[model samples]
Target: MDSSTHKLYHEHDFDSRQFLENYFSDKPDMVFGDDSLTFLIENFRHVFTVGHINGDILIDLSIGSFVHHLYSACEFFKNIIVLKVNNRCIMELKRWVDDRTGAFYWGHTSTILQEKEENSDQFEDQNAKLRSAIQHIVKYDLEKENMTDPLVLPLADCVLSAWLLDVISKDQDDYIRYFRKFSRLLKPGGHVILIGVLNITYFTVGKDKFQGFPYDEDFVRKALAGEGFIIDYCKVQERTAVSDLIDYKAVIFIAAHKEK
Candidate 1:
């Protein structure tokens, strides 16, 4: 968790605006579709996004979809708070926000220290290396008083975590603990939206290797049910991109609401 790790994690100058511009220019017709964005706008007021690191390109897609959905659903803008373990991801997200008109808050652990450090070299990509380095450095950055802390944040209308739980731990108990911690942040009747790879054995982002839990639809459903969240919907969708390096067949999108 030294300064070197911090430097590595925050070393990306990803042009999100340019990326989005290219994306929209290519697919202008479907860029702001009516289904997903409409759903997001009609349901959530405030959003808290987690697990968006620079190396993880899926964050761009996930957040982009969420934002587009919100914009199409609501006339005015809403507040957005992004929580990431990697400084580079936060920086890129901040840069993306700078060109747009919306309120955003960002926070992360200042160092690369984690509770467990056994599988440090799991992924072997530069982005994964930096992300893993940041995770190693900021393992304990989430404090009880911080809004980024999964257990203590104010009830949010919607909480989004993309590809987070699998990277946190391989043990199901540990995964459940993490999910429970995140569940505490939602207000009664609020919703949780998550996307993850199912049954993914392993993958590389930058220079770090990632081992995913053997997650299936049943496991996720049971986990959410255990947390008192009623599963409103779940789907398996494909993620297609030019930077399609990961071998995940489908991305699981889940929408669950807390009972009053």
Candidate 2:
């Protein structure tokens, strides 16, 4: 768990396309993934399907640089600001939002979300709306006093982080620091949507290996409680699919709100 062990944030080294393909290529066995896809949809739906989550702004802080996490969020948030650690990942996400060539197909994810919403099977219209809701895609420095740097945006109504802190942080203590930092991005009483990947230390994309933090359900519940948040809903999806692509025990979906 040494902070020095993480070198995945650099450009080109992370392989954004490969990362998406491995986890979200949409072939079941849970999409060549463990319960990752199932947990992703269910967790996101936990927020978006709720009437209280609708707001004017959402801050999505993610490491994988995929838009699928926001498949359910787009309709609820009028403006979305995506925060990224690497320049290449920022570019990769932008290409998809701009409808450029070579972007990974997230239409499959959209369909799943649409079905959850009880909406009609209209992929194109929904995808367009998702792209449009995202108004800003910018660089983020997690270790800084201000994550967005030189532009401290207004505190958002909700912060969406999926498999971010655990993958990026070096150890347990650093993970706690990152959690507090995330709270600063929100107003008091604002909500946080979290996806926790359990009991794994590393993952592979193509031939490249990335670091992950091994954590449990108790660690997550305690972390949020310690951070001044009330656990509103927490669901655990056991990893039932076998995949040589990555190793993880389970995924925990948490929807918590900061105490007023």
lDDT per model, in order?
A: 0.44, 0.78
Q: List the candidates' TM-scores in order.
A: 0.54, 0.91
lDDT, candidate 1, 1-260, per-residue tens: 22223211112333333333333322444332222232233332223223111111111113221133222112121333445555444554444344344422111110111111244342223222333222111111422444343433335566666556755545688778877766665666666777676765554343333455657778889989988888776666554433332345456767677788
- State the lDDT of candidate 2 residue by residue for 1-260, as single tens digits: 34245445433378887777777777553354336565587667776776368788899887777887787788688999888887778888989999999987876776666666554665558778888999999887876799878988888999988888778776788788998998888977888988877887777777666777788999889989998999988888777767665578887888899999
Residue range with the least summed lDDT across 10 consecutive positions in model 1: 106-115
In model 1, which regions exceed 4 Å deviation?
1-77, 100-153, 238-244
Question: By lDDT, who's the top model here?
Answer: 2
Give the least accurate 10-residue stretch of model 2, judged by summed lDDT: 3-12
**Candidate closest to the true structure, highest TM-score:** 2
